[model samples]
Target chain A: MYGGGGGHYDGGGGAANANSLFGGGGFMPSQSTAAPESSGGGSLSKVGPERADAAAAHREADHGRGAASDDKSNFAINSVEVSTIRLVGRMLGKVERVTDVAFILDDGTGKIDVNRWENESSDTKEMADVNDGNYVIVNGGLKGFQGKRHVVAYSVRRVTNFNDITHHFLHCIYVHLELTKSNSRLPSQINASTGIPGHANQVRLPNNQATTFSASGNTAGNDVSSLVMSVFHDPAIIDREDGITVAYIIDRLKLPEEVIKEVMQKHIDDGNIYNTIDDLHYRSAMNG
Target chain B: MDTSSPAAIVNGEILNKFVGRRVRTVVQVQRNEGGMVFGQSTDGHQLTIKSAMDIPVSHFMEVYGIAEHNQTIRAEVCTDFGPNFDAKAFDGLCKLANDKFKHLFL
Candidate 1:
């Protein structure tokens, strides 16, 4: 997937996997043509009872965390929820061995060591030029040997687009929030329809009752929800389609972070507003 | 826990903190060996998993591990899922993603 990134776009292939994090952003018009039939039946029925048990456990853990507990998946890269991480950062240092390459990468937030096991290929010669201070993206599995966290990079490439680093950070966060907050917490109404975990499934809200942010007997909660939504109306914040981060919402609403988190969670549960780019950032589901 | 900001951290950032502590996080499998697995967050941050039995990726799992440097995590406990994806919990995510990433889509 790493090496094919460039050629995949050039080939203009019909995206069989439209849900691909990197490829199928709204940027492409072909996304709608992705196979919708797969979104349906037989596959879900097979999982049966096992799926239910997992659902219960996931909810239990989430509820136990209560409202707004940093929810570790909050970071973008951390949120991809994969066993392997693909990181793009500046190389702080490097140590090259006959059979492997190791480098320390500082992505500004933190630093981690990346180790690349060299296979006999012409590619090994190309890596020799990857000296310290070179900005490169490393894709590898996480390995811990001798009490240290290291990225075992299977592929490392120099990033030609400088903006891609910043974009990668934001994109990682965006996808993570979308996956963790919005994707994992589907309303029961919608959950009943599709058996697959949140893949383009829609919860049919009651007829024409698009604005479901009703007074669910919690006036304060409803007020905060409205306030949260109102901020998007401000051209400045809403203008950036990425939506506003929870921090920005906290600043503008002048509400306690916990209170804001609780309100936001409630809205997501009730389907009032949906997480836009990332869970920390959000926008109204009305448009969705 | 302070809720003032999003306390998001990469698995690497928190590895040292969990060295001797009992910590829990949701993990997805990338590879499996008899009684051990290479797992990561849904986002692909890596961690090691050790168990008495070979656990496949199909099982949705929540793992508790004692963070160690050499192995990162020795899976002390695991909760399994019969199905891979949790639809009820993730529908909002799919709906939000229905449209590609676009400002107007919001």
Candidate 2:
């Protein structure tokens, strides 16, 4: 009953044959999507069982590392759990051995040894291109051996984009801030305050709740940018033709003069505000 | 290789914070004279780098060394970042790393 006019056993043929049966459509539907309605159900069903077995094998392999709860000492920086770390740095030195290869990497913040272990399926030929002074991106797990910590590298590739060097450092800083500052709101505090019955054990608190906590916790420190703009956007001052003066903002916010000036300049440059009477006086773009 | 003391990245503006400590910064070389390089830092401050090797003028050089003073670096290693490097972005990175996220590095 198949459209291509072949025996039922001929369904074992792959996409090309399936395409013909589907009236020569240019786009190829994936096996999983095609399997349910297609006439080649038998062959596709066989592939399904094989895929299931492979997935099972993959799950078994991942079981060890996936047990994050059991392993309390899993690699962490600033008390944030990090399973894999990606670092960009200059390769200071390299040592090759039969079982593994080790290289010292210096990324300005610190220097650490990154080791890539040899496997029967993979060859160390790719590492031949890496040399001293070459900047490389190392992705791996952090491990300690005999009291010395080193990165057990999964892959080491030479950096082609010059921007990656700067990007890596910025990324490190971003992740550090995300972990330490943003995620510092304890789950216990959320439980104590909110009393959300089901969310007592949940680590990921609601975004609004986190915002509320941070807003209430450190008003003067964290929200300086927003606080600066609030003066310009204030209902009382928003309609002023000459705009709000920097002195008024400083007096209202009670922040340092330098910070007020810097934030004002940034907002002006960003087109969020513009000069109304002079550079000293500014009006929010939102006012118009 | 004394890798234990990893250099903290600094721009001209924040060099004073890392005095007597290992630091790294990118500077655009303005002139070179007698083993000393005078350059403009990413943050547009004048920096004096003490180097034994000849440094290329008008090129961006990443200097890794001890911060001798507010605007001086005792250069241990210098890598030429080429003349076309982005100074403004690097300056922003330095500021963010030092100011908002100082705890991450220090």
Candidate 3:
């Protein structure tokens, strides 16, 4: 879940995703277009239970740590009551060759060598099981293997749970660092929502490509060029008509008239519109 | 745990631009919800601006208050919303953001 440094206008505000929010801080999706639905294509619902569960686990399993403590998909362990943890990542290499039935699955955290010795069903490891690019959630029990951490799972699920709700309810920005593809297996993981790279995914990144996510912004406007985003805000509340009001503290000059008009529509209501990536720059080039 | 004066790190514009005093840490601010404030300070507690009247919202700060509980300086509000920066620790966080807590900055 990483890599998405957005663009800036003429007076940038110091906003970490912590403070500065997109679309004026609304929490729903915008649905007010006369045009066809697929025109600007985006999701409209909140992330579902399983994906949300994985997201929490993903936050815990951030930046490559040990497997026992790496609660990637089974996050509610601390807050919620449950067993059978969930995990997500790529199947690195055949543990003992492609059909040997045992291998390491890198869940952005550390490699979790998985093995199903007793019940190796021929159809179990489908295209979804070994497919490297997509995200998946696996449920299983932990066991030690050759000093490396391992999980003996009875089941696995893919992250293809996309639906009509997904296209409009945007929550984050995840960037797929272009360079990760060079290696036979991209070691690092990229957040499809926020371009901010995590250590779980950082372990496999080639050195030079490591810093390309959040802070690496020589890229003009810091645009989310190839990043993935969800359109989750309700447009009825955001008043984009007044345009995106960016407070320019440098020269006290607000967002330029053109930049705001370019991205937002007019007469936006007030409670939705938090899925923007337009960057804000300083009026005076003090730091630049 | 000395309640005498809060050990603070000043990163605000008020201390830098206005006060030549250079508040390395603010021991405390006298909050009244009344009367235009006249400053009170000794050696380490001294501030440049006698009052918060002149500072802008972004320019000024009243970020911390002595934690009556354990004396550990914490955030004014606990929230799962907007950047949850514990204002007191702002100085300890490097400009480059290199720690778990510092990720809140990024």
Best by lDDT: 2
Predicted model with the maximum DockQ: 2
Which one wins by TM-score: 2 or 3?
A: 2
DockQ of each: 0.03, 0.14, 0.01
lDDT of 1 by residue, A1-288 (tens): 111111111012113222222211111000011112222211111000110001000010111111112322111111111223455556766888889888876443245677777785634754675777666655444443443445566556654444334334333324232223332333443223222223213333210111212221332322565456445434344346676777988887688999998867655543334455664677643332
- What lDDT score is found at residue A166 in candidate 3? 15
Error of 1 at B48 (Å): 46
- Candidate 2 local lDDT, A99-200, one digit each (tens): 888888776655667788866333375566578888766645545455344567655666654554665455444333333343455555533443223333
Q: What is candidate 1's lDDT per residue for B1-106, written digit by digit as tens?
A: 1111111222433445546655444456667888777766544457677772356675545555566663466766564532444322222222332233211011
Ranked candidates (lDDT, high to low)? 2, 1, 3
**Global CA lDDT of candidate 3, please?**
0.26
lDDT of 3 by residue, A147-222 (tens): 3335555344443321101111111111111111211222232222224234234332222122222223335222
Which candidate has the top score in TM-score? 2
